[model samples]
Structures are given as C-alpha cells and as structure tokens.
Target: MTELLSPTLGGAAAGLGVAMPMGAMSVLLLQEAMRHRRTAMAAAAGIAAVDLAYAALATGLGPWVASHIAPVEAWVRLASALILLGIAAHGLRTGWTAPTPPAAEPRGPATPTPPAFEERGPGRSPGRPAPPAPSGPARPAKAFARYVGLTAVNPTTALYFAALTTAQGASLATGAAGAAFLVGVGAASLLWQQALVAVGALAGARISDTARVWTFRLGYGLVAAYAIKIAFPLPTPG
Candidate 1:
C-alpha cells in the first residue's frame, strides 16, 4: 500500500491548485456561504464529494473516458459557459433591483414595561441585545443539488484533471494511491471551504451596502467574462 502522507500532501496540493482559482462555482459557493452558512456548508461538501469522485475516475480510467467522450465533453463545456452567462446576468439584475429594508416604526409611550428584573427568565439577560434571527429557511437540498450539478457537468474540471493525470503518467501504484489522493483532496477542500465560512461569519456584520453591491457586480462581471471566453473560441488548425 502506498503511504498516506505523500499521497495526502500531494493530493491536497493538487486539489488546492485546481480549486483555489476563482470560478463560477467558487463564486456561487462563496455567495451561498455568505448568505446561509449551514446550507452553504452542505453545498460545499457536495462539491467536495464530486471532486473526490472525479479524482478517482481520472486516476483509474482517464484514458478510456477521454477517448470515448471527447465530443460529449465539448458540448458540456459549451453548456456550462451558457449557464455561467445566465447566472451572471441574473446577478446583475438582482443587484440593481434589490429592495431596501423597511423602516423601523417609532415607539410610543403606550407600550408598557410590565416585567421587573425578578420576573425575567433565568436564561434571559435584561440589558443584552438578542441575537439577530436567521435570515430565512435554509434550502440545503436545493443548494446541494445545484452544487452537484455544476460539478458533475463542469468540463473545465474534467479537462484540467485529465491534463494533470496525463502529465503524472499513472505514477500512482494502485487504487490505494488514488484513494489516498481523494482523501487528501477532500480534507483540503473541507479546510478551505470551512475557512471561507468562518471568514463570512466574521465579516457578516462589517459588509456595507456599497461593498455588497460592488461585490455582486464583480462576481457578475467575472462570470460574464468567463462565458465570453468560452463562447468565442480561438482559431484551430484543420
């Protein structure tokens, strides 16, 4: 059996190398994390699961898949590009049309404070502010489905790994090596994604209206650019 350390480290580094770049999926994941942490975590885990599966497939059956599914892969890439473009347009429209929060109503003297300090519940604090309520219900299933769909159909991920496996030349000894690689990749993905979640939690209070608007715009623009790149291909020799 191949040692775990080498494969784990190599796999982690390889996974990060592929995943660290900001892409449509990354943006969506981050946005979800910022919007709803628990659901985003589920979605992130789903994406990691897809990555592990892909890594195994690439390691075990790279050549056969690449040979038999070249045209299908091309179509998937085009479809992904179109999807990205649609998401970008939606983001832009949403940012432009987001509604302002309703104004707070004025308090009147008729509102009476009947309870004294002695009557307060054991767990309740008199002066401390209550924690903000959850924004809304979480859609973990839908989010997970979207994450899985994007990852399963992403051509860039397939192409990138195919290239990587080809370059590595099946240097792996057996399925054990592939398993180790997947473990490492999954660990790294969990670490990075959780880190993003932490950052989102920490920064949730500090993000301003202007910053939020611009962030959406930046994400939309990047997605649009990626779509354009895919839609307009470079000339190839016959």
Candidate 2:
C-alpha cells in the first residue's frame, strides 16, 4: 500500500502536467465556461471521468485495451473529424456575417458622428428590445455527451497512456500502489480541471464581444486542424 501510494500520487501529478496545456478540449471548456459555468463544470467532470476510466483501463488491461479499443478508434476519429468540420463551418458562417468594426473618424475638421448602436437590422422598429441573452443553466446531458464524445475520440490520449504504461510495466506492482496511483491520477484530473473552469468563468466576464467571436472562430479552427491530424496519422517506422 505504501509503495503504491507514492507511484499513484506521482502518476497523478504527472498526468496533470501532461493535461494542463490549453489544447482543443481546454479551449472548448473555457468557451463553455464563459457561456455557462454549470455546463462547463459538467463537461469538465465528464472529461475527468473519462480520463480516469481510460487510465484504469490502460493500467490494468494494457495491450488488451489496445486490441479491443483500436478498432473503435477509427470510427471515433471519423466522428470527431466530422464534428470539428461542422464547428468550422459554423465559425466561417458566423465570421462572414459578423458586423464589421466601425472605421475611425478623421482627426481634423468635421468630427464624424459615431455609428448608432443597431439593435436590429435596417427597417426594424427602434422601440423593440434586443433578443434576450441565454441565461439558464447549461444542459447537463448535452454537455456530458459532447465532452465524453470528444475525449473518447481522442487517439493521442490513448496512445500516450499506452506508451507510458508499457514503459512503466516493471515499476507498476499490483496491490496498494496500483490503486493509489489510480486514485491520485483521478484526483489530480478533477482538481486541475475544476481550477481551469474557475479561471475561465472569471475571465469570461471581461471578454469583449469582438474578442469572443474571434476566439470562437480561432478555437474551432484549431479543433478542426487537430481532427485532421488525428484522422491522418503520420507514418511510423516499420
């Protein structure tokens, strides 16, 4: 048990180190946090749950997981690629239709009147209020499904853990150590993700509309790129 405790805790910390970077999922999570804190929390929890499941599967089943799960990885990659492409298309549409930034006025002579805020398009009634912003709690089911799908489709995540486990096979003794490592990794993941959600929620309030729009486009673009990389893996040495 004592031996397991150290390795498990160490593994957990290492897992956090690997996961802390702002990847596609992180960006998505941040975006969600900005839009809906509760939803973001649900999504983060789903991701962490999946990670723990994968970690346990990798640590315990090892090669068998690869053999059984590898086939599904292809379908998952395809689905993820399609989802990313859809998101990119949505971004492109939104970006194309987005209102252009008002040009700056000339400094000398006549001071130009600032463009009046248009609540609606031309011909619309001025008295009509703007559409209400979405304020309800995020849908837990949808958020969970989205994150779980993304995580499940991540090929690199599986490859990384597989490699790590294979290398550490000798050191991963059965009994308390194995259990401890799993617990540590799970705990670390939850802690790190929750922290990320909190930071994202706090920062979201300060984001400008233009900046938020651009971020959505950029984040989706990156996700599409990642999907492509996963779909068409680089050739390995024979």
* TM-score for all models, in order of appearance: 0.52, 0.53
Instruction: Score each candidate by Cα lDDT.
Output: 0.52, 0.53
lDDT of 1 by residue, 39-105 (tens): 8787777777776777777767653544555555444445545665665565566454544222211
Off by over 4 Å in 1: 63-137, 205-238
Per-residue alpha-carbon lDDT of candidate 2 for residues 1-238, written as tens digits (9 for 90 to 100): 5667667765675356334433345545655676678898888887787767777776785534334545454554455455545544544554444443333222333222211322211112223333222233459887887677766655545554444443344355464555676787688777767776886688753334465355445544554554464454433334
**CA lDDT for candidate 2:** 0.53
**Clash count in backbone of candidate 1:** 0
